[model samples]
Structure formats: C-alpha cells, structure tokens
Target: MKCLQEQAADGTHLLFLAAVYKLLYLLYTKDAATVDHVLRHRSRRDFERIEQSMQYVKRNYTNPITLKETADELSLTPEYFCRLFKKYTGQTFLTYVNQIRLQYFHSDLLQTDESITYLMNKNGITNYKVFLRSFKEAYGMPPGQLRKKQREVRDAGAISARSASSSGND
Candidate 1:
C-alpha cells in the first residue's frame, strides 16, 4: 500500500503502478498453478495454431497464402491473429511463414543439388532480388554460398577419413 501510494504520488512511478495493475489484473482474472502455468497454457495453444499453420504453409509455400486464410483457419480476426502471433512468436505472420519456407529451402539445399533459381521458383519467390536479400538476412549467407560451403565441408571430411583409413591400413 505504501509503495502504491508513493508510486501514485510521482508521475514517473505511475508507469510502474500501471505495470503492477496489469499484473494484478491478470492474476485476479485467472487461476492455475502459477503464472508459468497460465503462460504455458497460452503458449501451448498458440504454438499448436502456429504448428498447424506451418504445416499448411509447408504444403503450399509455392502458392499464395493470404492472412485472411490463415486467420480463418485459426478462428481469429486477421488483426487480432497478427497481434497475438507477433506477441507470442516475435515475428509477423508473413515473416514466420517465410521462415518456414526458408527452412524448406535449407532442407533442399542440404539434400538436393537444385539451382538457386529453381529454389526461388519452387518456393514461390518470383523476385530474385527480394529472395536473395531475405534469404541472406535470415540465414546469414546467400543460399548459393551456404550450399557451396556445406559441400566443401562434406568433401573435406570424406577426404580426411579416407586418408586416415589408408594410413592405418599401411
């Protein structure tokens, strides 16, 4: 009570008061084991929705995915869905979708010898410039460079193992 009174007396401390009010509001409104339980319940539901959307995107990354469609699937308004998604996942819906698409692209790069143009097209990225920029920003390297380096590392390991085996045999 004294802290609250002191906080109310000062304008700068009002922000802390507001934060405390919000926390109390949440605490009074919900009942569970702990704050972690409340948060984890919310997170689990959001992640289940995210996982469903991710699966859909994985199957349809080569096609258009409007926010409306995803929101509808999750039974949320587009605006609210976007806000909740960003709050829980730290990325906008489209950005998270692109991240999933990029993961697919990364998997392909690791497993297949597909050309970058093919990848961009396969992933429904028509703009080469935008694809390169987003891919590099997300993965910290151009797709081509990443694949090249991965190949080099794989080959070097194979060569080292072969050399070791031959020396041991001799």
Candidate 2:
C-alpha cells in the first residue's frame, strides 16, 4: 500500500511536469497555427457575444460595471463570462475596462482642460492614489505630466506651421 501511494505521488508529479513542459513549448512556438485555427473557426454567435460585451464596456465605463452585470447581459454566469472573455480577447474584463478608461482619459487630456480630480470623479475612480498609480502604469507617465507634454507639443507644432506658412508667403 505504501509503494502504491508513492507510485501515485510520482505519477501526479510527472503529470504536473508534463503540463509545465507543454506550456513552455506552446509559448516558445508562439502557436500561430492554433490561434489561426480558433479565429477561423469562430462562429457568428461568438462574434455577437463579444460585440455585446464591448458595447456594454463602452457605454458603462463611467459607471460601476459589475461582473454580474456583464454576465447578465450575455446570459452567462460570472465565472463563465470571465473565462470566455479572457479566452477571446486575451484580457480579463477588469483589465479591458481599465484600458478603455485609460484611452478615454488620454483623449480627454489632449482635447480638454478638465481637472484631474474632476476626471477621476467623473470616471468612477474613487481612490485618487490608485487612479494615479494605475494611470502611470498604463501610460508610463502621470496624467498631469502627459497633459503638459501634449500641450507643449501642440503649441510647438502650431508655431512651426505658422512660421512655415509665413516663410512660404515671403
């Protein structure tokens, strides 16, 4: 019985090692064939499901979008929705929502003179510190710094264009 137990343990370890090896192999290969296979075989139902989820994300970014809300929209359980979302989009729902918020924030920085605090409040970001940290992580710079840099670039470009037009007139 002891020997049988030891053999079972060894078998489990071997299975774990095999799984690790297979994962490494897939990563090394970049697995284009499998990815293409999945994409090519994706059905209309899959596309419709993803489209609905994306629409929900876009429309509700400034609101508290719970997993339950998304799951209900798709008639899926939260767990199943999470798994399907990650599998199809290579991003979890929370990560995807943050990406959308970051994109919206970046555009607002370029186009508007809104206060950062106001933007945070408007975007459902309650924690200023966490918002700053996550924004910096996503954008490689603080929001204020990015806004300042964008303004400088825009001003410089405008000045250069004006000078070039004057030179052409001369």
Candidate 3:
C-alpha cells in the first residue's frame, strides 16, 4: 500500500490501480453486484455483533459488568463470547474493561485533585492490590507516583510562566 504512494505513475499504473480497486470491492462486497447472501452475511453479522459488544462495554465500564452478562446481552455463551472478544479485541474481556477504567482514572488524575483510592473506586476498580499492580505495569509507576510527577511538572510550568511575566514587567 505504501509503495503505491511512493512515486508518480503513468497510464499502465492507472490501469493497474483500477484493477486493484475492483478486486478490493469484490472482496469487500462479496459480489460485483449486490450481496452474496451466504458468505457476506455471516461475516457482516459477526462484525456487527462484535461491535455491539464493544459499545456495551464502553457504556458500562464505570459499572462492574460480568462476562456472563455481556455474553447474555449478545445472546452468546460465555465461553464463545470470551473467544470472540479475544479474537477481535486482542484481549480477554476483563482486560478490556480494566483498560477502559484505567483510561478514566488517568484522566481524573490530570483533571482532579482526588484521592487515588477514591478515583480507583469511582472507576469501578474494587481491588487495591490489583489496581496497583496493573497501574504500575501499564504506566511504569504507581498511581500516586504518576500523580505526584504530573503535579510537579504542572507546578514547574506555572512557576516558569510567572517568572517570565514578572521579568517582562521589569
């Protein structure tokens, strides 16, 4: 794909590009005409179902949701849902939920002066030990350390701005 954009092309290249596009379209739509009903439907349905599961997770991340509940929501068995979630998202179900909660927690760290425990609990992380290990693994430090570093950086920037402004006044 990058090679296609590397250089200018002439008439033969234009023809080749057209053929490639037609081939891609056929592959995506299954038929040169409408739909193939057999292969396309199965793939499209599975993709849509997986997308629906992801949206469900995003909506309910701040609440503790179970694998059984999510699987039930999509009318799939828990075992099958686990496999599908792993296949599409490249992580197990709980891992994905934790990632979402961690994102919310990280945002709150920057935006609020809340306690670490409070933020973690608010993000639906009920286990302190698990949260500590996961946070350290993902961010390369514990939440408290990350928070302190961010504060130091913010304070330094403020002090620099004030010094610059005072110097300009002199």
Candidate 4:
C-alpha cells in the first residue's frame, strides 16, 4: 500500500498493480515438483533461442521484420522457427509483431497528442488498410477512437485513485 501510495502521486500506480498480479501468480502456482517437471521437459537451448527472438522483436518491431530474418538471426531455419514459435508462444510471427506494435500504439496514444496516422507511420506500420484492420482487431476500435477511449479510461482511473487517497487522509 505504501508503494502504491508513493507511485500514486505520479499517477503511475497502475503499473505497480500489474506487477502485484504477476507476483501473486508466482506465489500461488502448484508445487515445486510440477514446476520442475515442466522445466525438465522443455529444452533450455530452445527456450534461450526463443527468448533471443522475442528480444529481437521487441527491439526491431518498428522496422520491417520477417520470420526468415528472425530465424536466420537465431540460426534456425524458417520452418523450424515457425513451428517452435507457434508451439511455445501460440502466435504467428507477424501476429506477435502486430500485437507489439499495437501495445506501443496504445501507450503512445495515451501519452502523446500525435495523430493516429502519425503514430502508425512513426511505428513503421505503412499500410493504412492493414493497420486499421489489425489495430481494430486487437483493440476492438480504430486507432483514433481507441486513443480517445483510452485517454478517458486513464483519466477516470487517476480521478478514482486521487479520490480514494484523499478520502483515506480524512
């Protein structure tokens, strides 16, 4: 609560709330042997390669990215990389990249006053048709409208947090 109170001053406490949920998941999962069994069944090298590929995507999602390039960078064939990536992460490479792009768009939309076209172009999403389709598919709204909706949500959350804190003081 103290940490929340401190971060609340800057309206950044929601990020900490997400961390709290993640920590709760780690604490509430089943026994160590179940964890050990799962860990023992998966190849560490394969996981490492996938982790490397995810890091690559996070760093380069704003650029033109392809499965072949990521596979080659990870020293795996495109087919193998696709199979492994789908099995482990359950998203096609392009879908994953688009999801990352959407997340970036969402954050920037909430923080900046840039137009949707500008934000999409700045994020390397060149095709307006494709951008609109994917952005709507992921967020259930078009980018321009999504920005407005997200801003309203964030503003409401900040107001609620402030009210709760002020009332507690009294």
Reference-based TM-score of each model: 0.66, 0.68, 0.75, 0.63
Highest TM-score model number: 3
Task: For candidate 4, write residues 1-170 as lDDT tens digits.
Answer: 98767888886777778899888777767556677777766668788888999999999978999999999999999999999898879898788888888788778877899888788876768778887888788779887887788778999999999999999999
Tens-digit per-residue lDDT, 1-170, candidate 2: 99768968779768878899999988867878777777767655666787799899899888888888998999989998898888889989888887787778777777889998777666666667767888899879999998899889999999999999999998
Expressed as tens digits, the lDDT of each residue in 21-81 for candidate 3 is 9999878876534456655776677778789888998898878889999999999999988
Considering TM-score, which of the candidate structures 2 and 3 is the better prediction for this target?
3
Q: What is the descending TM-score order?
A: 3, 2, 1, 4
lDDT of model 3 at position 62 = 75
lDDT of 1 at 101: 70
Report lDDT (Cα) of residue 120, candidate 1. Answer: 71
Clashing pairs in 1: none
Candidate 1 has its poorest 10 consecutive residues by lDDT at: 27-36
RMSD of each: 11.1, 12.1, 15.2, 26.0
Candidates in order have lDDT scores of 0.82, 0.83, 0.86, 0.85
After superposition, the stretches of candidate 1 with alpha carbons farther than 4 Å from their true spots are 1-51
Error of 1 at 93 (Å): 0.2
Q: How many clashes show up per model?
A: 0, 0, 0, 0
